[model samples]
Target: MALSNNNSKRATLGLGAIAVAGLVSTPLLAQDAHQLIRDNCVGCHTESGTTAAPSFSRISEQRKSPEGWLMTINRMTHLRGLELTSEDKRALVKVLADRQGLAPEETEGYRYLLEQNTNIIESGINQGLTETCGRCHSEARFALQRRSEDEWKYLVNFHMGQFPSTEFHSMSRDRPWYQIAFNETAVELGQRFPLHSKEWSNWQAAARNDLMGRWRVTGFVPGKGEFAGWMSAAKTAEGRYDVTLTGRYADGAALAGEGKATLYTGYEWRAGLTIDGVKMRQVMAANEQGTALDGRMFLAAEREIGGDMRAVRDQGKTELVAIQPAYLRAGESTELTLIGQNLAGDIDLGDGVVVEKVLSRNADRITLQARAEGAEGVRMARVGTSKQLSALTVYNTLARVEVLPTDAVTRIGGAGGNMPKVRAAYRAVGYSVGADGKPGTEDDLRLGYMPASWSIKPADEVAAHEKDDRYAGSIDASGIFTPGDAGLNPERKRSANNVGRLKVVASVADGDARVEGEGNMLVSVQDFVRRVLD
Candidate 1:
């Protein structure tokens, strides 16, 4: 099947440009964007003139979420004979995000869900819709979409046709799903989130802002620590932005970074940078107003540690910026502080969240005692109209514990020939079950990230009998696994000294309740069997 083609077999009502953007390069007047197509992509993709692969232009022609591009890249690599290194994959994906990504204006109300940060969680547009739509996939996946009612109906039809058993799924089987989708869901979805909007038109017509100045950055990096910093970005060429960052982690360690980025559809952002000797990547959304960039910056080496980042202009007027430890247990109360500029007045902690009393307040900071009282899901952390999403989730009890990256990888090192060791930081994600008492169903709630006691053991008891844990590595208090030094042990019967499968386990003791989760990792001798691309 072709990777991407414009409604090759499906009906597509002209919904205007799915993702809007101004051309960044010089106006070539002919074969401009196509030249780019042939330059980078034509090596593999081709137009239907008589080829098996779809044209590169088809990709540029359609609009999609970053997830869509990732799914495509994953498919191409695993199934369609595409080859790439991690860095190469990142570069290609960033290129597509800028070249064929959604406009920030079109994605305004959806930013909360789209942001890849820990301070927030997925929230549905409404209760009923949240259950009907969000139960299966992320709310951002749905929020990033816009369609006519008929087109939305067509989507349901497509799902039914493509996956005939979908209607029989637990979420669907419990209700009149098909009927509701055709009547209530489709109609309401179109009204609540229509494919056409004046918001996009206005933002698209407005003058674009250049991100070529000093920016104040605030964020926390999981595992390593929190940081405050500044950056200066210079646009070197069309769509090319170069950034220099200087910052300090919470522990006062010097942090620095430089990065190259390509702006996608004007607002979609992706970049790679290094800070404080750590190599990382940035996936963010640029606001239409051009005041801020909010997203996640993650370690590039592995799915180890990541956190949220916000970059705003230094001179811009600021209000209550953020809430430290933005969450608390329902019955228990904790002091929540707001960090920002030009702050004042009483703060509204959104629905279900109650601030018992303001402990203190100042121009840039406000400390207050608040209780969640079992108010699960999210409430806007609001100060008037200004608000950040997923302010809090208070639960009566922890429903379930999950090990993020349910699977992981790390290499065993020995001698001077061993490659650099990579560590895995496991975090326990807690959830609260709602009325249904089901872990994954709609009523289930997210408890954000929770502290856990960590341990490591052999995933296989047979491997344990082989003394895998003894030969493997050690897990630290914060869930970091330091693999045993790379080397084959002469005492072992196997020729290889220290290679085996391990289970990283995290446990949390809450009074009489003990919650635990585990993830599997294979301690390999090498980074790759046959390294392909870099």
Candidate 2:
């Protein structure tokens, strides 16, 4: 992506010049890509060049996913006090994601793990992984990254250097940390995941897509419930987009909004929106190949508390994009529809799925009666060779609800601060027992993640006395919380609804059984403003 403004001293911030210098993959978007870094980063990150902080060029050698870049920026802000507007932070994250982000295919097999907080301890995992990497952090932290073996080696060295006692840590001392990391694990990691792959390279070279049209959107926010909306994207400026979203929260509340966004790397998407007076932030990925745009949208100030944001052009090319419901109960029938470009044909719903007949067919939609007969896995349907679609045929049975992220944080608001109160977004995943009669075994069926009714209450004795119900915030049926403004009134001592620990609950009903999962939420005062005060 080429920025319209290329002559400013700050223009060097764009990867275009560097791409030409063969420093990295061809940059997709330019201009505003690295404005945040140019304004605050260059002062020490590059201007100092060889000081304690590494230069941007040095850091550019490494590749990371969108979340990885956010982690780095967050580390800097928290430790080094890097200042940036939330908007700038969002843009900077998008810029780095475009330049260094990993392709979905690159992080395959780990999306579910990275997405949900899974229990690796009692679960089957890669040999030696738990003892080595999992000892200090989550697999989600390491699994999504792509780096050359040497880069991985650098990481190992960095870890040991930083920790000093890493090798002597109980988990590593018993095992040869360096020997396993450098020889066996490192080699395995390198072979399985390398920084340079055709996936990222091709994605890097693709033309930036101008998302100017209507889109169909579906996603669930933990505290807000499941929402379906339509968004209109129109080009408002070079590389900048204006968006209008209209929809309804699952509770039947009207949802409507308008926002602005910047598209980077032909796929990395960032948008600032407002819905019902709540400011929101969106970090989504657009897959041109799949002709789909999907990512997360959350409170403008709190990213962890967001919901999935997915969209397809109100209409597109010869693509069999999806099969609603994605699965069916064996021996049961479901009326399935094909959503794609020029979707036409005798529908094949997959093994054990027989399209009773083509109920209807339009240029962009096709409907059929499909029956699932004892089918249990992914099934692909094809219309001759033009359309190949995939869906799941499974047994619809209540299993267990797996809450996502394990934990998340939401914050209280301040005096007229643009930082609208943050709401925690939770995902409820349902699973079916496998052939082994267990819910977690390899044979267990995946029912997918979804939204649920939300509830929140005090999680501790302190919260109980503080009367979190009246102070922390009130959680909606969708799990959204509108925190009490900052300040201590007669009801409290602290000068704010600044702090509270609450339990965010997601309740999902599977037939007659109502299942619920809980996660912790730390509702505190504004982080950035508080940091600034410090």
> Which candidate has the highest TM-score of all?
1
Give the range where candidate 2 is weakest over 10 consecutive residues by summed lDDT. 12-21
Model 2, 1-534: lDDT tens digits are 000111111011111101100112223245445444667787665533433333364355566765566666776787788887766666666667667777657655554332221212224557577788776655555767777787777778877777788899877888779888877777776766777889888877776677777776766555556566678888765456788998665455768888787665555566777776766666666776635687666554343455666777755455565555565656666676565545555566667777777787875556677777754666776653444355554666756666664565556665475544544445667677777777767787777764477777788888888777667777665445556675555667654455788887778776577878777777766545222110
Candidate 2 global TM-score: 0.58
Cα RMSD for candidate 2? 9.9
Q: Estimate every model's Cα lDDT from 0 to 1.
A: 0.62, 0.61
Off by over 4 Å in 2: 1-57, 66-101, 109-133, 142-195, 205-208, 236-239, 250-252, 288-290, 316-534
- Clashing pairs in model 1, backbone N/Cα/C closer than 3 A: 98-264, 413-485, 413-486, 414-486, 488-497, 489-497
Residue 439, model 1: Cα distance from true site in angstroms: 5.4
Overlapping backbone residue pairs in candidate 1 total: 6
Candidate 1 residue lDDT tens string, 125-206: 5776766666665556666765667767877786688778877887788888888878888899888667566765555576
- In candidate 2 the C-alpha lDDT for residue 217 amounts to 71
